[model samples]
Target: MVTNKNKIPALRDRKAALLAFMPAFLMAAASAYVPMEAGLVLPVLGFTIMAVFFGLVVLWWQTETERQTLAMQLAGLEQEERVPTAPLVLRPPVIVGSPLSVLRELAVSASAQEVGAEIVLAPTERVQPARFPEPSLLPSMRRSSAEEVSRMRLVTQAFEADRIELHLQPVVSLPQGKIRFYEALARLRLADETLLSPSEFLPILECSGRASDFDRRVLIRSMAIARHLVARGSEAIVSVNLTAHSIAEPGFLWSLAGLFDTSPDLLGKIVLEMTQHSWRHLDADHRAALATLRERGVPFSLDRAADLRFDPEALADLGVRFMKLPADLLISVAEQSDGRYAGPELDVRDFASALRRQGIRLIAERVEEDEMVPKLCDLGVPLAQGFVFAAPRPIKPEIAGEQTASRPFGLEDAPTLLRRAG
Candidate 1:
């Protein structure tokens, strides 16, 4: 019975093999049906072709399986080793063993001292004792935490006090550094006249869940700036950076829409910007909010992208009109692979062309060095922003602080200062 079962399996395999070659057999027979010698040659050629095709397919399948297995193993290792390095208060203390060991050690020492026994216990194997953070270190840590909280409080107070400042950095055209756009940056002015950049206060705002408030303020200021530029007969657009937290907030779109209703011209003059991290982590609600804003004629711009891996079609569908990449990053990537390799499945050289096809413009930012200009131009990047051209300059407090302008901005009033920001 066992032999019959094994023979049945071999018969099934032979049947499948014959079925697979049936088309080739029929073709060979049809090619030379009259002479058996000629028919033999046709069959031999057909069988050889079929064998090579199947062999190549099998080899591809095997190699693909190996590649996938290795990739999965590597991913698993990376995930296992990954650590959180943000918001120090949230990070757990580094302890080799259970935290309870410290308490247990203290209890054992107390009991041993109470017993008044001078017994020396011999250790078979040398082992390190449990280490705990020092008492003095605790006060320093507390002070740091208190300072962080104080800074966060100061930022919150700044929002309430209307002490937020709006600064604009020019995003100019390549080859000719003509200003085309101004990226709106927020600064916090404390009571002591110290100006805190977004880098210093934004993290505090986000951690305190006040990012939405900040975004709203920046949007309002950016809209005013855009209007000012337009009223002066300048065709410059103002891009305002928004956080995901703001978009995800309830009634965020409603508020934004209301703001847009007040100034309809902002539709063409204002551009909404966000970091790549915020864009990737957006949920359905956040996307819906963005979609509502997009429907209202607000365009989006992606900034601070970690890599050059961008899907032009997808970004356009999401209403992304501009993408900003660092000039150094763009140059390094192009130099490394001759502009062929961009992330896993993109070409750096072809990226601008692809984006342009989708009505998206690439803006190379952080252009600190003058040498980066020709390289950026060669890469087909049309727009560039950084300290190489002009640092972020304040947009005159009277103009930015009020809806009505004191006077129109002239050529000198433009943020064209050639010096780097201090």
Candidate 2:
């Protein structure tokens, strides 16, 4: 049974409690224990104590902040477990780990997590008629799939309605405040302008073979931003995500080339980002398309990779310029029962060094804590992006100029710079 039920730590963490009180502890000790009338000696002691206090302050911040963030996320997950699912007569095959549904579930879980919701762990016996007193499992599964397809089609209506939006998030260079690159994230806007979580929509979109269309729209939007940045002479690279469907599409690269062939410079400035899963299933057509893009100076990257299913060195050999991984998945000290780390159980520091050898810059995403910044730096990760630095915001039209705008200048740019915020 694959359930979203996870090991959620309690809200309070030990180090966080102690770390919050450290400042007061120091102040009290300084006032009560140190003699104030010792003239020069008192000033020296004060200076020494303040120095020590600040040093420990930095230490405590580096340690407890990430722990607190994890604790908070776990609490949120527990709360999500309480959010009721849409009740249906027959459960989907994913509940039973149906081999036929593996690819579908992969797409769903990735989409769910992208929207900050993990697929909750559930029991495996759901599809058995003996367990639930339902009709034959095969027919029930077919019917549930039909309903799932209906849900996907309804969510996908936004595309036909022209309700797609782009949100920009910056990936900053290490220890430098410079915006090295910006990642363009896809957001679906409704007729009422309300946004839907990718988790709620993307699963079935991928299943329905409509993911390529979505990626194409996002690419067009990203090109508009890239054009604007080039006008500003911004050295910052603009990254746009490409889905597995888009990557494997035989004609997608040709379509993309046609879209930007007029301005070859923009293609050079844009970096297409894919996930490990996206690259995992790449066949001859994907390889050819990627090669053609690389030849045209459109670099590719594998970003937000959680799985170690592929060889990073092999990816680098394919002309991938960078690899970005989520911070939690890349660097966790938590040991599993099998003596593995929470993720792939690789020594991140060493794995990073290996990728670097292949000329791939390792980037850490979703980095929210100050502590992680330095640890990432130590691990040889040269780039980091997350809410800790900046959140995704809408690009202003004037910021990019009309010549470079992907869409017509309209009221859509009305609330300039106000993030659509998914």
Candidate 3:
């Protein structure tokens, strides 16, 4: 019995208000209705009928307004995406002292307490040299060498009592065509102010049954560094080297999940650099853990590919997308093999071609010669790391940006530009 004029205005006002609540109402309605429908509930049927009728009316009205708003936003977004970006032009490379080299020096010069102070300082002033005083040469010379050694031993013991420390070298990657920074490596610092290379300490840790502790330290520290780098707008990855003992540990997989449960953003950026040393000891549970990591976008890479124990084809099968070859392997293969158009068999070109066919990226490590540069290009190695390229430096925000911007566009510029860009 309502008049048309009165009914129309009331309907319009109700429709607009209903549209404001539509999405949440519709979601709740659908959720309730689905379970009710499955259970065949009479009350659910009545509620769902009312919900559908109301939701449809609100949706029809809202669609018109939303369509217009979305159309305008889409047009703006499309325009932004379509705008051409300028290629990153490079300037002459800057010379920065290596972060790893500095740490090595600090390890030799400072007590563990001083090392902790320096690491705290690293985030703020990474490029600046540590301010620790050099060892007193004249006084030490005047003392019996044994006395100087005893004094140093006492100082180290005192520092170790406090248990403050820094561990792990950050592995950084040169930006390749589609890839950003590859991965990070872990370096351990000891109580005696000695820096232990993974190759040295890792095996001992495994044999001494302390691999799990070492792995935990590496993972936590590497993740902390990765989070710091990401906070600075760099999208570099941190690769942690895991030992067989650590990977094979019960609940290790669940521990990883818990580690990343709060920071899912780190999942894809964490690359597991699994070595032959780790691979040989992996069990079914470990393989399952690796599978889980792969499913979560945490890719794996085979390290030290020159070690004949590693099977490239097997790694490819296990979904490892990258492999690192030692400098000596490239040199040896290039010198020995007979391949197409070879003075020396172009190891980078030949090896890369083979690996590419198998869907793997070949990374040549310790590449330190201008003469070796052309061969790498011809070999089409996607990544090259060495002193000739930039030596391992601290992953500073500005330097990280520069590295990303200078990446080569294709294999055409792979040699000269890759080294220069690095």
Candidate 4:
């Protein structure tokens, strides 16, 4: 009745031919032709490297299919994954001091004041389903594309012309009582003293393999500031960030070694932050460099850790002592499936405890509103940083100058205070 519609001729022809010849080929293969004792030999294509890659892809495809099927089976064991299916809205990272940042803060503040803010935020706070990596139509990266070339040139010129600037944002101890450290965020300084976010240039530098230059500049500047802080007797730490791919760069490591040789005490004071995503690009060289630094008492900080891909145990094994999580993510996770988070959830406290056991501390980032402070405190997050504490700004040029009364006897007054007490 259906008239055998939509039949595939190519498939039908292949099946018929295979049915006709496959048995003969199998019979010949099964029948021992020569009297030689050789067991069996299958002719393999000569392009060994391509063959290996094809085999790996085949294996990977099989493994991934099994994993996905198992995941679906597990989902079936649980109740509906997302009841009404709501999207947990996340605030995009805005350029600090931009009008958009201001409006975003106002909106977060308004929503946070609502009594059911936590409930309003969560669809299911238990576990995030793994998201498939987006596939590309181009199959492979085209590094020689015109747009790519233009961007590479732009970032290259910015580095050569010394347009890179480091802006510091304070990370404060909870209760907004004390400043613990300052995070160094890089920017492109415009003629008007405005800044360009990393989106404007970081990818360009990375694609061009010129990220090392920018990384070196930030490290050198951070080292200089570390030295300045030491001479000024400031106990505060300066946190610097770099792509994981650049961790093993010889120049940056050389500069770091020189700084450590002269100022070994500062090694423990400085914190290096890197995103989890960048670590996926790491090679053996960077791994060795991290191990060396870890031996030298330099602990690393983890950033961009609000995803299912983030494995806390793996991070602990990597000698990470600090993690910075977005406040919204933490808030969203704190709320239960039905938005009933009246008390501290067991999973959150257990997670915080586990990390503490591994000597890793959690710092809630983007703490824009006062409303979120109590939530973070309840969750056992010890430190926070956002517009509420301070925005990204250039630290004063005289950072090494006389200490203010509010600060306890920094560099200039330490000796004087000791003398007066004596």
Candidate with maximal TM-score: 1
Worst 10 residues of 3 by lDDT: 413-422
The lDDT of each candidate is: 0.71, 0.66, 0.54, 0.62
Error of 3 at 38 (Å): 99
Candidate 3, 31-107: lDDT as tens digits? 76565455656555566667667766665655555555557778999999998654333222232234454556545
Compose the digit string of candidate 4's lDDT tens values, residues 169-239.
88888775498878877776432233567766666665556777777677667766777777878787888
Measured by lDDT, the strongest candidate is: 1
Q: 220-329 in candidate 2: lDDT tens per residue?
A: 77787887877888888788877655565569876776666777878668888887766765667767777777777777899757654456677876778888888876
Backbone clashes in candidate 1 total 0
Candidate 3, position 79, lDDT: 100
Judging by TM-score, tell me the better candidate of 1 and 2: 1
The digit string of per-residue lDDT tens for model 1 on 32-132 reads 76555755876677676886577455445445555565677789889877953322121122342333655666565566555553444356644444344
Which sections of candidate 4 miss by over 4 Å?
A: 1-154, 191-194, 248-259, 279-285, 308-314, 337-346, 396-422
Model 2 lDDT, residue 176, Cα = 85
> How well does candidate 4 score on lDDT at residue 207?
52
Alpha-carbon shift of residue 397 in model 2 (angstroms): 5.7
What's the true lDDT of residue 299 in model 4?
79
